[model samples]
Target chain A: MNPALVALFMIGFTIAAYIGSLHLYRKYRRIYTTPVIVATAVIIVFLLLFHVSYETYMIGGKWIDRLLGPAVVALAYPLYQHREILKKMLVPIMTGTTIGAVVGISSGLLLSKWAGFSTEIIHSIVPKSVTTPVAMSISESTGGVMPLTAVFVMIAGIGGMLIHPLVMRYSGLTHRIGRGVGMGSASHAIGTAASMERDTLEGSISTVAMILSAVIVSIIAPGLTLLLL
Target chain B: MFKDKAIIIPIQIAMLYLIYLAGKGIQNLFDLFIPGSVIGLLILFTLLSLKLVPEWILQQGVSFMVRHLPFFFIPATVGIISYAYVFKGKGMLLIVIGLFSTALVMALAGRVTQWMVKRREEA
Candidate 1:
């Protein structure tokens, strides 16, 4: 097949999946409705059914990857919008986000090691808490598998977003800020989306938390990987 | 918001690429653990401090992007098809570890923030 044709398939598949996922979310309004999950499912099946090589998909898929930086930078809008709330909750948000980022990385490192995974796998697991782009960068810096790190991030993001309501309901953790900060710090962007489902305040706060955690974790992940991993 | 601001996407993309290059330059020079995009983020965020981009431009750009944020990640997510074999055996274990660590982070971070806020209220 022509390379351009392959790229078109990749692009068409992604756009269609995203549109379908958006419609599903509009109707269902659940985490399962998220475009990430739906697109992932559709793309996987599309690949298998068509027998397309991952490399061919990546030819155009990499265009999306390149946008990640700008996408991340775009997130600054919400962070900027939430500036006042950030100022108000600076102390606790910082302390809590930092603690969460550290615990998230350390636990991933320790657990992967305890589970008897290889050192390389463990490195991939270490930055599971941060956002995807940043986590991939950390993974590469520390010699972790790039693709694996992205998988781990989506897993962690989806898990945290889904599990938080249950955690709040059962654990008696009811504070709005508590929930938002926890989800954002632990889960990053997807978690922020989940937080947004509740109200604007939680959403904005979560966005800020995810932003702060991205910067903080990126700074510290290398050191943490060294001392602990 | 979409009418006039839609034009800003090109400008935003240009800014994003420039910021990325700045980050990439710093990255190559120093061998930092962070990615160029992140340093791009830092530069962008600090640039945010300067208030150069109009508020509507920033807001509209972000909102449009955020709505379709997951679209941008489909490639990376689907790229996992390449590494399916890596998780062939230990897939369950890796995912379990991932979930457990996430749960712990949520639990600890939430509890700590709640406790600190309560203490402040008491004070």
Candidate 2:
């Protein structure tokens, strides 16, 4: 297949998946558990069984991934539109993100060492709390594979999404501000999406926290990795 | 929905190309410094915050991308296939440690943040 043709097909498939998932989400109103997960699993399984190389897939997929940065920036408009509420909660949001980023990196390093993981793996895992791009960069700078960091970050996001509600219930943490910051800090973009589905205020707060955590982690991870390792 | 739909598609394509150009420009500038995508996002955020680009233009493109963002990761995920042999040894131990420790830290971070917020609220 021509690379251009493959790219077109992949874009078509991606758009179709998005539309289908949106439909299912609207019907089910359970954004986290349904369409996206099912679509991702099915497509991934198909790709794997067919022996599609990631590079080949990415010949098309990179076009989509290229937009991730701008998309993140686009999040600001919705955030800006809701600036009044955001202004009110800025203190809690900033404080929560700072605390979350610190604890996340510290505990990850500590626990991985305790579990007998090597320094490289520990370095990779510690930044999983940040968004993927930042985590991958941090991992690379600290002598970990960018690809491996990507995987760990995705897994962290999925894990945070799956378990957060249950954790919230168990811990009796119900305030939207607390929940939003915790979700954003722990899960990055995925958790931000989950919070958005819950409410606009929650989503905006989570977006702010998520971005702050990523920036903070990027700055702090490299220095900390040197000291700890 | 249909009226907006028609406009959204073209606008999204245009915005995506513009973002691509912006990203490339950023990458070029930062290639001498750091990686470009990080700088590109920062630049984009700055632009958006400054209202240099209209929100509506970027919003559709962003919405389109975010909705299907996971699919973009499929290629990266499949890279694990080539590493299966490499992963057979100590790699397994590393992955186990990595996944669980990352999760544990994430949970701890969430809990600690919540605690700090609670303490602040009480004060």
Candidate 3:
């Protein structure tokens, strides 16, 4: 089989799968149907079923992966756009997110240690609470498995959304600021989406928290992971 | 979305790539621990805030990338297939950790922020 042909096929197939999954996600709106989750599943199944090696997939996959860095850099746009709200709630948001970042890193590290998981797993989960790109980068920098880190991040986002109501009820997180900060700080973009669906202000605050937490976690997770782990 | 001005999109993306390269150069030069993308984000952010880089330069390109951010992650996520051994028996444990830690962080962060807001109002 020609390598160029394989690369082209893999690239086109991935795009098509993502588009189809995106539609399914919009229509059904379930965690399992998330475009990335669904698309990855579809691709992985296709690879396994047809006996396609990950290395072959990477021939084309690397091109898509290359864009990830620039895309992450582009995140500054949203962060910049939301500067007004960020300015208004700087103190509380910062206070909440800093604490959240510490708890997020420490809890993952300690729990994995208690469970007897290996160092690799511990490093992966440490940055699980931040957004995917940042989390993946952190995972890479820390010698964690990038794929496992992404999966843990997805789990964290979904789990945070699922438990939002219960946590709010028992934790007295009634205020919109608290709700937003909590969701975004803990869950990243997916939690921000869930928060948005509940309240506009909460959603906006969640966006701010989401971006701010990324910066906070990025700066601190490496040092904190070493310190606590 | 750009209508006939579509050429601008790639150019803007190229501009972003240049910044990413600059960030990587800095990371290598200083032996910094942070990823170049994040450093690039900070550099671009500072440029935007300081009015050195016009927002319009990044408008469409950045939006396109951000909107389809999930798409870019698909390949990496798909790479999970290779890690079967790592996750084979730890499914339950991972789920428990994911759920528990997430809940705790959400509760505590929310509580602290709400408490601060309340105290500020009282003051």
Candidate 4:
């Protein structure tokens, strides 16, 4: 009956479920089994079955959410590791990221508008291309639902991975740097991880693009959303 | 070796948390539009680049966090439980928007970068 005990249970359950999901993903190597989706699904199912409310779940969930900030800050270490390549290819990376960032925001807004979604949903979709923590914060500041933003971001990442081959083959994206830029700028962390699996150079370059895209999207999403939506 | 890790990893994580807090404080004081975490990321990147903070100090803890980064997002993603009504009747539309926009951005950004990189090589 103690609240703290329930909170601890929820936290432990989440970690246990995640470790299991991670194992499944490593074994199966399927998109559907991606640990984030699998772990979230299992936890949601458990809560619904037990009649636990989202608010109660958050007593523990919020603690995990709190670490998201430091995890984001840790992204800097990878960027620092690849600083030399970053410096050498700064111009092209910036150009590609700026273009990708603008298109990503505008196109999402235009499409969401055409679909007749509310402004709040539009705001969520606007930052869907950036990294999760950054996107969630942007969504919060812009009057969007943070959870929906995360879902939209997940969808974007998976979509990018699925269609990347077709896009790369037809678009003549041969260079590792270009491939990395496209994946990171458009798909964020999920894409970067997938790119890492495919090629180390691309994976590293995607790291740069992912971080830069986050910075650029955070700066631009507010003003751009105001203009479009 | 095990004892050293036991001491260092926590300290490194603590240092990261301190930077994150400082970033939040700066954001509040300056009225910046950027999120505190991102501000923290930039600060850490600057510190790493300037060699003010040695890489070895934060390397293990940072790598551990980065490796399991997706784990942190699970809780937030599960918050979708409360917003199911908002997404009803809009699932197909959102999927279409995500797929279409992602593909477009990838192609265009890739093409532009490829062109620029090729031009540089030719020059």
Q: Per-residue alpha-carbon lDDT of model 3 for A1-229, expressed as tens digits? A: 8988888998999999999998997899875676776788899999999998899999999889888778767777877877776677789988998899999999999999999888998899999888887898899988898888988987787678777888999998999989999999999876876775566578667766777788889899889888987
Model 4 Cα lDDT, one tens digit per residue, A1-229: 7889988998999999999998998899876777877898999999999999989998899989898888778878877877887788889988998999999999999999998888888888999999877898899999998888988887788678777888899888889989999999999877876676677678777877887898899998889888887
Q: Relative to the true structure, how large is the alpha-carbon lDDT of every model?
A: 0.77, 0.67, 0.83, 0.85
Clashes of 3: 0
In model 1, what lDDT does residue A70 have? Answer: 74
Please name the candidate that would achieve the greatest lDDT relative to the true structure.
4
Those runs of model 2 whose alpha carbons end farther than 4 Å from true positions after fitting are A21-32, B1-4, B16-123
Candidate 1: tens digits of C-alpha lDDT, residues B21-111: 8887997799775566657666766667678766665565566765566677777777767766766777678988988888888888877
lDDT of 1: 0.77
The reply for model 1, stretches above 4 Å from the true place, is A140-143, A196-200, A214-229, B1-13, B118-123
Docking class of 2: acceptable
Q: What TM-score does chain A of model 2 get?
A: 0.91
On residues A132-219, what C-alpha lDDT tens digit does candidate 2 reach at each position? 7678778877888677677677666766777776767776667777777878888887777767767767776777788788888888
Better of 2 and 4 by TM-score: 4
User: Which residue pairs in candidate 2 have backbone atoms (N, alpha carbon, C) closer than 3 angstroms, thus clashing?
Assistant: none
lDDT of 3 by residue, B1-123 (tens): 456447887888888889998888998899775567768878998999999988877798887777776677778767767765555676578778988899999999999999987887688
The DockQ for candidate 2, computed on C-alphas, is 0.33
Cα lDDT, model 2, residue B33: 31
Q: Which interface RMSD values do the candidates have, in the order shown?
A: 2.4, 3.5, 3.3, 2.4
